[model samples]
Target: MNKPANHDERMAKMTFGSVYPHYVIKVEKKGRSKAELHEVITWLTGFDDEKIESLINDKVTFEQFFEQANLHPNAPSIKGMICGYRIEEIDNPLTQKVRYLDKLVDELAKGRKMEKILRTE
Candidate 1:
């Protein structure tokens, strides 16, 4: 499906908190733990468990969530398709960052090793 022209704008306004639960469910149903999910998130965004909880409680938008993030230096290595978009090819920086997180979560759910998912290996 074709994304709307305002896709980036719409995604920017989406609350990270609203999407957090779905991520948890997706990973957990595949036998991954919530802690593992948090690890992936931390690897990408550098937010620890406490900070993540706070962000979830505060219902921060994706834009705000990323603004405060110390994005991992290795993030650019996260290449592939997510939500029908080639993450490396995305022109908008924010959208690419969001897709990076989605790709990490997808890898985790697919049972990839943590080191590989984090690009440590």
Candidate 2:
């Protein structure tokens, strides 16, 4: 039987701009800087400052946002749970990408060292 649209499905349809404010709020509440959040996003998506700004200004959907992104090679190294789901194990590729971003932001908000968050050698 067909299932109802889940959060990921609904989220994919939503604009990244629409969701960005919430991310900013979440990190800011934890004392993380907006620059840090943007840094992480740029690291993961390979979106330069101008690209991200344009995407946000254009109100691109998550589906479109990721479609246009040049995901980092180490992005797969970002494995863990977020919102109760194992990001690495997510069956839907798009959902996995979205959760990967979420997990990174969560780590930043939790005060994880940037080196560890980026999984740098």
* Distance from true location, Cα of 103 in model 2, Å: 0.2
List of clashing residue pairs for candidate 2: none
Candidate 1 C-alpha error for residue 53, in Å:
0.5
For lDDT, the strongest prediction is 1
lDDT by residue for model 1 (1-121), tens? 4789999999999999999999999999999999999999998999999999999999999999999999999999999899989888998999898999999999999999999999999
What C-alpha RMSD separates each model from the true structure?
A: 0.9, 2.4
Off by over 4 Å in 2: 1-5
By TM-score, how accurate is candidate 1?
Answer: 0.97
* lDDT, residue 58, candidate 1: 96
lDDT for 84 in candidate 2 is 80
